[model samples]
Target: MSGSLELGHHSSLHQAQDSSKCLDEDGRTKRTGTVWTASAHIITAVIGSGVLSLAWAIAQLGWVAGPIVMLLFAVITYYTSTLLADCYRYGDPITGRRNYDYMATVQSYLAGGIKFKFCGFIQYANLFGVAIGYTIASSISMMAIQKANCYHKQGHNSPCHISGNFYTITYGVMQIFLSQIPDFDEIWWLSIVAAIMSFTYSGIGLGLGIAAVVGKCLQLHTCIANPFLVFTDHFASETENKGLKGSLTGISIGHVTQSQKIWQTLQALGNIAFAYSFAMILIEIQDTIKAPPPSEAEVMKKASLLSTLVTTVFYMFCGCMGYGAFGDDAPGNLLTGFGFYEPYWLLDIANAAIVVHLVGAYQVFCQPLFSFIEKCSAKACPASPFITSEIAIPLGSNRCYKLNLFRLVWRSVFVVTTTVISMLLPFFNDVVGLLGAIAFWPLTVYFPVEMYIEQNRIPTWSIKWLCLQTLSVTCCVVSLSAAVGSIAGIINDLKAYEPFKSSY
Candidate 1:
């Protein structure tokens, strides 16, 4: 009787400790994330290869529409994001059952039958598309380094065509190893580093753009040598047709056909959309935060505001400067598109930073998919060791790394599939635009508006409801326009382009 009593005492004590340390208020694994780490993840996801295309986007829209469209997207994104953040829990912001991912939040408050399946398909499909886009983008940056070096030696006019195939495979190899990382929370350090890398390249692009404008002014012997004056004078001259600089109306009808100009302008909207997109992954990042006295929803709103502010500021600087430097002729990628060739070494550094940032951003966007696949597999076969087992590899000093076989094999296959698909398409700007157009309205605007209305029991046709619905409709039309323009661009490019055979 005494021995039995002692065993019961020990078991109760163990349970108490486990309950306190291992589980959060929601009875899930305790999350150690904070505002800073969450912000890092947001920055890593938001500022991607999309920023490199912003200059081209501006060049297509001219000085007026480019910055306006970008700012408009920023406001829309931040507003919708706060709505999504509030949906993190079903009934209440804090006490209710947490919707662990975006699809769960949708199913909780909205129709689940078709809507659930559709949400899952769209969310995961968008993530898959991002992986392909990053693959294409990183390879482009890699190729740019080699091409930059070649330009330094050979003349800029010389044919320095280099195949992106090798560089694409190289990136795939790196991702294969990084893919083995088990979960989103474990990759916090990588996200922080990637966030720093993002700032590095963006700042460099802005600096080079300013330098280019100065260099052009000196070459032209303009009356005003100041960079600011040069920009104003250049824009005025271009608008008046005195110089080949950009105009108030964007790429002229002479440079591109009337139809082509229209398509390019619409496509530029999609590029800006892509640059601002992160809503698809926002909830996933929110899942990493620990319980708050202030609640996860409150914390996420702050993070969203901070992230949007930082990204919008950087986007304006880089995009405006790039357009100011090259005018209507701004390249698709500011750095990799050879906007500044003479600063070969600096260009090389910026491109390298881009590759490094994309490597981490790809994992940031894909980890939720990995987790979803693993959860489904485990649910289907809970008893199988392959699905449930974790082999702890000893690292000496009483430490071991837990390795899961399924995570290894599945993530490897996922990376390889995306790599092959990237090689086939390899149309960077068109692909980015399509991915943005496909994901923006549904993931960023539509679902959030619907979910917020349903969650809060807002009466239909009321002022708030009508306003929200109007916003959703406007975004949907924009998405459709962008999709059409991107598709048209792809068709035009395909007239001479071949899969896996073209060189940059």
Candidate 2:
């Protein structure tokens, strides 16, 4: 994403003009990643804590509408990813070219002074938001694991609780050490491990959901009509009043008024859309592929297709099973919501996977931001050893000392800042909706389609072009509406929580 800024610091205008010469001297060479490794990076980018809430999202839409929305988002995102892959070229289109990062792609094809600047701003801003989201979500998962373990081993009233912020701050400090790795391409092995963790937790969630449904079915002696029916049969007469404690009881589509139904539907749309947001970092991942030119594009496309296939299957299975098991009462996070009893060990394993996966996933998303800051700093301090490595000076020079000091202080500051904000407002689902709404059109849908149409000089009024444009505009409007609604919901939730001084 910071490819354009990389020029500002790493290469001068003279060097930029001679890039073609350098490419000729270097020639085509195998890069770092293979199809499997690249696919792992895509999986790490696509799957996150968002998967945990997809059941609640589907419950809002009910049985018929849920899968449709999830699949639709998957298809839209996959196509946009391919469009991004096509724009990865760094030089001339035909003969001798290299791949460009996200921001550079925008600068190359969509360049108009203000337009390019705005694109860069939103791209990086969305990335920063993602970093915060990962930190916050990971901490919540860790905290939940600790709480559940305590309840399982000791009594419910035992003093085994730890603060969520403590775990978040600790994770942030760990990131400070991990971020010292310096580049994205160097972390393929880490991404692979993270991908495995994602699959493990997702599978565990699916198993728990299935088991819940089977257990319910055995008691009823008949299959439940839907998730709504499951809730009605089990909990309808159990609670005296449907209030805060009873919030988990399933809400039936048949019971809600038209206005309430529409509101919930839109909220579900926002959540599913948020779950599939990985297009922003497509180019950066593409840069890791080993093949050259045309082959690079093909390799990236295959990786994307494979990752989408895997995630879609997992998503459908988990979302459907979760809704079936818990209906409207499903917890925001399936693992955290599990009661600390029969399957306590499984819950612990799942939460541990989540925490570990986020550790790696955070780096995948935040490395771009780190690179951007480093480039900006290098541009400001041309003589600094942090960027230049002080090759001209002795290893023990004072400039190198400043460089080490700058690295520690600067990175620690970013980590601490994100950790503090995450501690302040820990509404994971609503925050995700807002981030998705803000970034969905620009990052996932708009930029790629616009860049494709303009770059290829596709006819403006042709049916194909018109259809793409209409889809883009429709999604932009819907996402903006969803974003506003999410903000309103967040405000209401804050007001509701304020009187009690409840802390996460």
Candidate 3:
């Protein structure tokens, strides 16, 4: 009896060890990312070439309104992202039952029929639009760097002009390969690097702007003799043409009417919302947090707050400084805009950082969409070899061939499609504005707030609920107004361009 009891105790101990090992592996496979890595991912998603536009955005709103609106968006985004983080817990907290992605959360909280379908469609569309925007921005960044290098080496009028399409196609093709990475967790390192790059260029740009301002105050004519300014001055003698249009400065408040100011303010509001937009991938990123995911909500809350604080400070600094430096004539893209011809090396570095950051941001937003499409593809072609289960593939046989072929074909086609669009509509800032206007309220405002109310079972007439409802309605109106304005702006831009002309 003693021997049997001793044997049973040892056997039970071994069983417990095995169970613990299984749990560890399961957790590892489930949530492969940590708090800081996830925070880096959030930062990468939020900050991008969008920051470049904040200066222009602030210009539209003037100094006082810009920072306030941006901070307001920051607060709203933080609260909604926290609501989303909390909803990641499916049933139990400590038990680790969780919804891994945004769609899953939507499916759980929102209704099934039309609501769920619309949610999924909009969510995926927003994410896809974001990826396309990144692709477009990456190409533009590359072109800007190339142009700066050429002008530095040669002259501004050098015949070495590279077509923007060339860079767009190049970056798009590169993304086709990079997008093949199967999981979000696999690219946390990329996000970290991208996040750092965002801060680096932002700091550099702000420093450069402040330096220019200080030099101006000290009447340092040497510092203001930038190639861009020289070009503007030289071209001013000629007829009014596209090349000679100089940057705008000052409030110029007296020049526009009240209606125009309100319209511009609405547009600026939309752009600010866009600058803060990252909700489509919030839950997907949150899912990367390591389990037991009961704490994912808290982790994500902290991460979102950290990212928001950093980005808001950075946005305010860049926007205010850039506006102060350039005044009303701030370029739509602060980096690529006119008057940046000098300091080729610094410009090149900043644009390169943007390119690298956009590459990672593209993947961060696209991975979820890619996963969704792949899943649908597998379901549709159930009998295809590429769609086989692990057990069916056999241990010794190579299963990667069919999978790789599918990835190559699908992702390449997607990249090519975006490349074509970028080439066709080379209006970079206008297109970004349109995308933001269309997607801002739907993804960033309505869905999150509504889902939060439903998930928490808050009464519709309650103060919290009514406040969010009013905000959602307000966002909707603002989004519509901005969309119309953006479309008009794009139309006006197109009138100046002949078909297939190299915008660069």
Candidate 4:
């Protein structure tokens, strides 16, 4: 069982060569993906709607602990991701047959079992949750655009209420067409576009934060949020003494209940965890890299490292600057939270970029799930034309899309379902945290550690083995707490919320 599966490359290679000159060892069309493309995919996945919430997450965590926690997560994710990379090809880190997706990678090294099934369920469920989260996130940004313009026309004090329900439906309609992208390779251009948009908005958020902090550097600010908080023990004296507005510990009892503070801190961990969740898609991205001198694992390690470094830098700038700017009052979404309303055009661009980035990110997370369901359908009904047949739709210049009826109907239904759910329960921060807390340990930690140990033949309870297991167990506890916190948040939100009628 430790040995690699039988090599099936030759027959496919031979057949592929007969029809085309460009072919990989597995007899597929040559993979043109380079380190840049792979990195683009990783960035697009990593720097998603999650980053918008970083400022709020940090608000829950004080300045000292917030960045520290982010660094800890970054280290853990990078190390485990490299392990996942090593497991991408079964039985050999370099030359063995590929595991095309996360489930395949799990099946290869860990073997098919209950845990394997659990991985599939968790992965797909997380993907679906991400879809809903993105819908909620993008709708908020769209509504923010309208609200921002309204504030320009009206005063800053004007409510400028806008319903997110329409925006959610609009995003779902956009996804219905985009979701038809067959696979990761086909969506390379989209990923690149999304990655660029991520940078655009991230830079804007960071700049706005810096501008806010510097613009008020000399001002002796009042405790504008609350009259009582300024003098209360909960609002630490350091807020006035030091020019920032949070305690060494985060928001305290005067600002919120003790229980709420506890839950918010744990929920903040989930938000940080969510920001580093490209692991589920890492193998699929690695599968795209052309046959390598450095090896896909090595290339992925580099990409992982680079992407992690880049993301950490962006996150720190955005989160820290945002916290510095608004202090304890930092909003859930840095751009859409109305922290900065002037130069509404810039705010408009940043929000537009978020919408665009999420469109591609949605497809990125969903493609593997789409592939899984379609494969199952073909297996179940091999003779059904509805499942297998495709209609040729022309795009001119000798280009055409093979549109599948089942894919169309099924993906459309999936989009609509997520859209409706998002409308019903559009608690954005809570949803993001819950999804992250649910997926982080199992998908991001446990499986990778297990697979790496199995593939490397690491002996039971050896020093390295014990250390790795300890890390996994620790992450499990963290995930549990984050989940509880997020669930509590959602319940609290529902106390006053009306489904499909909530407005911003």
Return the clash pairs for model 3, or none.
248-328, 248-329, 249-328, 249-329, 250-328
Alpha carbon lDDT of each predicted model:
0.86, 0.73, 0.72, 0.85
Candidate 1 has what TM-score? 0.86
- Candidate topping lDDT: 1
For model 4 the TM-score comes to: 0.87
Instruction: State the lDDT at 422 in candidate 3.
Output: 71
Cα-based TM-score, every candidate: 0.86, 0.79, 0.82, 0.87
Candidate 1, residue 120: lDDT: 90
- Mark the regions of model 3 whose C-alpha exceeds 4 Å error after superposition: 1-12, 15-38, 91-96, 153-162, 185-189, 216-265, 288-295, 386-403
Model 1, residue 40: distance off in Å is 4.1
lDDT of 3 by residue, 187-299 (tens): 98887788888877777677656555444232336634676444334222221222211134324657555555555556666677788878877887877777654477778
lDDT of 2 at 176: 86
> In model 4, how large is the Cα lDDT of residue 354?
91
lDDT of 1 at 415: 94
Which pairs of residues collide in candidate 2? 90-98, 248-329
Q: What C-alpha lDDT, on a 0 to 100 scale, does residue 104 get in candidate 2? A: 79
- Compared with the true structure, what per-residue lDDT tens digits does model 2 show for residues 129-218? 877888878888888887777777886566664667678778888888887666777787888888889888877777666555555343
Runs with alpha carbons beyond 4 Å of true place in candidate 2 = 1-28, 32-37, 90-96, 153-162, 185-189, 216-250, 253-264, 290-294, 339-341, 384-403, 498-504
